[model samples]
Target: MDDQHTPADTPESEERSALRRVAGLSTDLTDVAEVEYRKLRLERVVLVGVWTSGTAEEAESSLAELAALAETAGAEVRDGVVQRRRKPDPATYIGSGKAEELRELVVAAEADTVVCDGELSPSQLVHLEDVVGVKVVDRTALILDIFAQHAKTREGKAQVALAQMRYMLPRLRGWGQSMSRQMGGGGGGGMATRGPGETKIETDRRQINQRMAKLRREIAELATGREVKREERRRRQVLSVALAGYTNAGKSSLLNQLTGAGVLVWNALFATLDTTVRRAETPSGRTYTVADTVGFVRHLPHHLVEAFRSTIDEVADAHLVLHVVDGTHPDPAAQLDAVRKVLREVGAGGVTEVVVVNKADAADPAVVARLLDEEPGSIAVSARTGQGIDELRALVDRLLPHPEVEVEAMVPYTEGGLVARAHQEGGVLAEEHTAQGTRLTARVSPELASALRAYPDYEGSAST
Candidate 1:
């Protein structure tokens, strides 16, 4: 994860003072007391995956990422294995032979847990557990575990729980060691060492599902408020531009550069899961809202997407998207495709995209050259060095929506409200004072133009 997603800030320092508003920090366990306590300790885990396609190197990289995720979730990866299969076996995920091999690997490594690289059906999970005689978790569960550990805000926690419950719903099994408690009945030289069984797991699943429903209602209420906020911005005609990219693609770095958002740019997957928006001014002196959204990844769990639909909808509604890319990534092309796939999944497929190849300072020139050659209009820049930023800014100015009409208007001094609204909601090119009224040359949105037309004192002909 360190090598994958580092802070993309430049040394010349695009850093700015922290803003006054406190918002969107996740409620994950990062805030828990650091003192010694009796919480669960990290366990030894064996990583497993089935390779259906892709080069051996690609498969290895994917497994390496899974390892990083395990570490992030406070697990030690003891060993790993990959089984080549066209489709994961319904019963064991991997073939039975591979399962036996994996069991041996776990025993050899003394691993307490097995983590799979793909989501497994409930039956598959139960079968695998029975075969391996260890805790079996699929990729979605692992990702959710990471989210549960990392979420810091109330909303973040609620969302993570909702997603987890949805994923666990179908996988609820009738038997589990965590369920049946030892009844301790039959004694007399023949004591039974019974354990928790599946019934408890089923009950837990039901409770989780109930809680999930409640959370959905709560989030729906929150979404109402969000919609109101969005409408307010729309009423103000402030163009919203969302920054989206693969996890740790220097999005926060670029946001900090463009808008002075002091978002913590860390070297970790899902560093900025919560959305951060800041006021930004383009080179042409037009003001707009810029939002840095949660970074995406390949094969992001579907439940996560469903749970985060409201949050991701922000991307769909954006007037323009700044698709940040790590120029130094081994496969920038693949990274770009992953992002695009998520965008399409979220129903934001047709939105305008500006491919931003970030980290120019550290990126291989050959990669940069090839990317530039392939993507005709993509901008290559070192967010840390501010290289090519000016050009990027100009591109932003060109891409963002603006007022359609350039006209001169005269208004009475008393109508300062109109004047201020014009400056705030529309682009005011020039202003002057005369004895009869205030003279202004401005570029105004069509909607604002209609509103101005209704004013009784509206004067000054169009400057066509």
Candidate 2:
């Protein structure tokens, strides 16, 4: 071979030229590069919203919340678009032209999903999906997905599953052969084989209904157990306070700070799904049980509210509700309204609520001051730094309903347990040791007052 063409004796310039020729041949052999197709690891989503009411700022804030919700659901939000409309388009929610624009944006962003900021009707959802050419989910479904992801406890899982099923039952669509009816077959065949059986959609609907029914029964049984526990607490005359708030508003953190519950706290939406009750003592040594329940969101799905009613009932049955708000949230007022709306829906409207501005350590002082002014009597505190906790405890102590009965009881040393019960159940105003046994003056529950009657020299008054 020639020196330039030989394997070991080729010149450097000739070798480079030969390598380039080979590369060109390889490129020519395949006009298109062999792109490896990988399944999308994360759902890429584009958000669309209609500004039906409220200012542009409010509309943008709502869209921002939807984006946060999408992120919480493990979706990468690629873009967000808001349309100014007097009302949502009955057919497409964002109207046909805006829906087309959204489709273009979604395609340009390589998004696989479109999330609407507001809940859409069935027709609207179908039409939007047809226009966007991808999976289209509304705000309700997005929140439900987040809930389904975060539910850990059995009851929590049941509630979330039930909500999802209910949401899905309406959105169930028939696609080609999946919607076909099964043909019934008989042992003898003939006309029996031609008999029509249930369609796949009907079967799915029936199965979902049956599952929802089962979940409801399970939830009812769980609710009964919770009610029994509540009854026991009532019998002991222990005041119950519930920590209620918007998702990720620091309720669990506050619960941990106040009661050392050690609840799992994360900086994500709907991090804690199950209700957690922890015993906390006030500054005056009065004991109360604080329950941290599921957080609320704006336009929370009605199915979820119904399914989680058993858990949320903790808030309704509470003697006081600490409405925790994220002080650093852009629209704390909107969050407050959202919470209040759910409270009303769950029959917790009449419950006494104390606004708690949480995340004070991270919030702007001016924002905190404004919240305090807007919420009158609202306390600003940071669960992380323990700021203003003492004041919050004192305020809780003051707000808890007090026993009206004041009593003086003299009992033998053998009944020391009853005396201790008096201290546990109500405020002990006075105590003294006497020759007979022990003299005591304490405000107690009616039941405790009745129980103290078993002792001698028991005098009761209706004044605290």
lDDT value, candidate 1, whole model: 0.78
Indicate the residue-level lDDT of 161 in model 2: 94
For model 1, give the 10-residue run with minimal summed lDDT.
17-26
Best by lDDT: 2
lDDT of 2 by residue, 221-296 (tens): 9889999999999878899999999999999999998999999988988988999999998887788999999999
TM-score of each: 0.81, 0.87
Tens digit per residue, CA lDDT, model 1, 1-464: 55543333543222211111112211123435631241557778888887779876676667777777777677767777666566789899986766887788789878889999899988899889889899999899989998887677666777888998888788766545656754434533343634433356666776887888899998898778878988898877888899999987999989988988887887777866777779988775677888887778778899888888888888898999989999988788888998899889999989998889999999999999898888878999987889998898899888887787766667678877777767755678878787867787777887767656554334445333
Which segments of model 1 are wrong by more than 4 Å?
1-40, 176-205, 412-424, 433-438, 451-464
lDDT of each: 0.78, 0.84
